[model samples]
Target: VEAPNQTIAIEQSQSDRSKKTFHPVKVDLPGDQITKVTLGRLHFSETTANNMRKKGKPNPDQRYFMLVVGLYAVSQDQFYLLSANVSEKIIVRASNPGQFENDSDVLWQRGHVPETIVYHGRVGINTDAPDEALVVCGNAKVMGRVMHPSDSRAKQNIREVDTNEQLRRITQMRLVEYDYKPEFASVMGIKNTHETGIIAQEVKEFLPQAVREVGDVACNDGEKIENFLMVDKDQIFMENVGAVKQLCKLTNNLEVRIEELEQWNRKLARLKRMSSLKSTVSEESKVSRCSRATSLLPSKKSVPLKSNKVKLCSVKIFRVTIIALIAIMALCALTISTLCLLSVHDRHFEKHPIYRQVVELVTSSSVALSPSTTTAALQGESTISQSTQPVSRIPEVNFCDILPCDKVYCCPIHLQKVKFLNYEKTNAKEKRSRCHCINCNFIMLLSKISEIIKKKTLFLIFLGIDTTISSIQILETQQSIDSRYCSKNLQCRSGNYTYVIPINKYTPMDVEISLEINTTEPLIIFLCKVTFGNYCSPYSSSQNSRKDFLETTQGRQHIWTLPVAKLYDSAYYFRVAVPGFASCSTDPYFAGIFFTDHYFYFYRQCN
Candidate 1:
């Protein structure tokens, strides 16, 4: 609010209108009737009880009183004695003015106060102010809205708050019901009943600016400053605005997701309806074509033997045509179904950002599911210590065209309600066996191991040196020796050998390891020093001389087997040392590990 400027008027002296011999005299009230004062100004003597000149003039020793309008209560010896007439104008000027207590409330011209006016006692407008309060200034304009720049687009350096982050902060805030203590309650006149609101102390933790420190008051010896805190309700509410925005954003996202789901559902229903319609149309068309062809056929009764042959030929042709039409219709239906499923699947996956990662996981699982008979993947306690080469042409069976090859591979892992394919169990006394199918290397799970172990199924651990893997040593546990299968009786070459042949261990107990020998020599293979520990160097010769050794000899041996009690926990390694010598070159061929189970199932691929 800007204050308007005005010129200060100078009043002329009225002593010129008086007689030349006349001196300024003190005006007496009631007895002498003074009709008018020249220049509309009055002065009072120094001795009067109420003197306007004495109050307005700076000097106290003035002989004659200087004049001014006097608007004040006087010594009330007479009730209505003082009266004066002004011809031109009357001006009342003061540094400070007293309150006006009258019948009529004085209204200022042009809605502005000429000078400062102080009022005592409670003054009320639309609102009340404390006693002795001056004029009240409020931010609200006459239109009842706070004043501010109207344009929002003109703002500079604007930054929008992260509504999600603000929502988290709001969740961290605490709301409590509290009551002021005795002294404070008495002062506030809100003593007993509890007030529910956010505490300033608690709110300060998350929203520091919302709770301001007004300043500390000095206490005791003036050394200690006590905290004086206040909560800005407006600031707290402003922070809450962020939470509202966050909720709105969340609601919108949820709405979009729901809409997408609805669209997906609708598309699926439409595809199903189309499939039904196509099938129905194909059946009707086939029936109609068959009927029409039969009507066109010649009657056998009206023809000879040659004509009968021609009729048969015509009937066969018509039947074939109907069949061909049916086939074409079926093919069309299948194509439409495939195209529709793919389109819907792509659209669905596109909306989900994590579909790429899902695809990767699916692809890896599909690679593991490829058919393998020569390589076995161990599940459960057993694992593939040695990696395998990636198999070419992973067989992909799409139960649903909407899913990729990996989806079929990962179906077992993700679907908990489905059981794995059951494998037939073999007798423990069986000499030796190998799974010759893809089902052995792919569809197995850990649950099968426990059932197999309970059945006393002797699992065969076979090792063979092939072109793919140069050396194979079947380990009872994950920690198996890195060595080729060598005979103790007939030795070829001496070197530090280490190999990791995958096995499926169901329990923590040792598994019986037996080998199927293919060589023509009387071979004896022995575990020079069977140890079970990790971090052992594969080339370390320290265990070669150890006395604790297990030797398996076969008089023209076909199966050199180890006891089931010898195998330890998960990871264990053993050494195979050949002490004898065989100078003759013999093809040391050993097959892969073969376990006797009811069904062939693999946990993981060799790779």
Candidate 2:
């Protein structure tokens, strides 16, 4: 309705000039907690706005709405209170308010809730008719920014110039910015804050790419983040295998309990039905005796016998009815117990360690390890050696295809991975949470396939080369002929249809299939590459010479496929280049390492 003094207020302006331009007023907010404050129009509402403010500043990496509604009616004191956060905390006060109305209706009604809010526009109470907010003054701009409560850069200045108003200003800066993310806020930590193109952008605050990069190498600076290269491939794989084994055992136990409950219910139902039928038969027989007693009750001499027979029939009928009812009650009790068991099963799905283990197995499968990297990471080698065992050492008879139940997925990890959550259930919506942690390393493969490849390195490292690690598709490959392959937008003619290049001929395909993917992590794909070469042969286990080499057939080849998507999706790839090496020497290199143009034999471009 009216305009206040035309002077710009000074807030903490940053080095960037755009951030410095706003007229500012602050409420003193102290402490490190999540806060949500709602600003109302000119007059103050003590009840609503004061209640809505929460404590603490949010980390910039996270995604939450810093919702700014359009300006409501400004009070004479030049205040435009805005609603914030889902929780209700609303306040409206002008620095020097022109007393508009002290009536309860004016303040309380406007204070009830926010009026019509236009997206990215001034939020305000709609005038009884088109009012002055329509004038839309060019001098006034509506923008909001959150401040870091404990900004290292701002903290120093505030402490030096510590005054009540200065302290309030600093505290207000912190309070205002508590909800704003670090990326847009002027905090010194330089947190990773990109609004778009962040894979797992919705997944978490940390870019999966950044985390993977940090995980792949060593954190030598004593920082929390380390790269994947620094991680022990074999050790991680073995540890993951152990976690999967534990999960499989847990799953089997839950299944057994379920089966037992089923059996108990079947017996209980049958017993109740049988008892009811017997009761019906006995009651009929009792009624027949009563009919027989009618013929003998004509004289007084027979009165005593007739009375006794009637009494006996009633007693027998009552006893049989009670027994039948007891059986029915027992059956009902069993059914209730079964229902309770199922409820427990559904509720614990997220809390179950087996479920978490299954997530780990899907994320960490068939990874190669690097040796001599982060040797100190495993300080207690004896402890790890005692605890974790390689997949090779833990022999499984699950590959036996003789019977139905005997057919466990040839890979122990796949056999244990959770799928088909078909039980009518309720659980924490953790489908997003199932994404793999960056450091998980576990290998999964069919048993026969596992025997074909010879591991050449005591320590072989599998490096995922993607532009952004978060974009990588790391998922479990199926182990069964009937399993489902859930690829997005793919025309899967059959359930078993998979994308693997057929390598029947030595050099049949020349079209480079470029997987123009953007990721900074390794990819999870089923690859088949064949070559005829004098590849580096493994050194003899019993040979005394360290540099000893053995000659092998230099012109023979074989076809191979890794079961991976049955495991996880971790990288993005668009270009795939295969090595066309016809001849190479045995250097005791890692065998069966799936290197997409990054490692292994390459086709030499002859000059």
On lDDT, the leading prediction is 1
Q: Pick by TM-score: which candidate is best?
A: 1
Q: What would the TM-score be for candidate 2 when compared with the true structure?
A: 0.16
Q: Say what the RMSD of model 2 is.
A: 34.0
Q: Flag regions of model 1 displaced more than 4 Å.
A: 1-111, 114-158, 191-193, 216-225, 269-607
Query: Per-residue lDDT tens digits of candidate 1, residues 1-607?
Result: 0112422233322557432222434444566575555543322211212224455553243221112233233465433335542122112332111211111222221223666553324554433332234323222236675555747788878789888878888898888887755444443334354777887788888788888774543332434345767788877776789999999989998986687567546656776787799899978876776566556666555547456555665676688789889997676566556545544554443332122222222223223222221122211111222232222222211112322323111111232222222222334554144332334322232234454466433221111211122222223222222222111111112222222223222221222454333323223343322333211123322432234333543322334343322221112222221213211121121111111001011121223
Q: Write the per-residue lDDT of candidate 2 for residues 265-372, one digit (tens) a residue.
A: 665677678779988987788778777765655655576876787786687668868998999767656655654554354344434322232222223335421111
TM-score of each: 0.26, 0.16
Query: How many residue pairs clash in all the candidates, one count each?
Result: 20, 92
lDDT over C-alpha atoms for residue 288 of model 2:
83
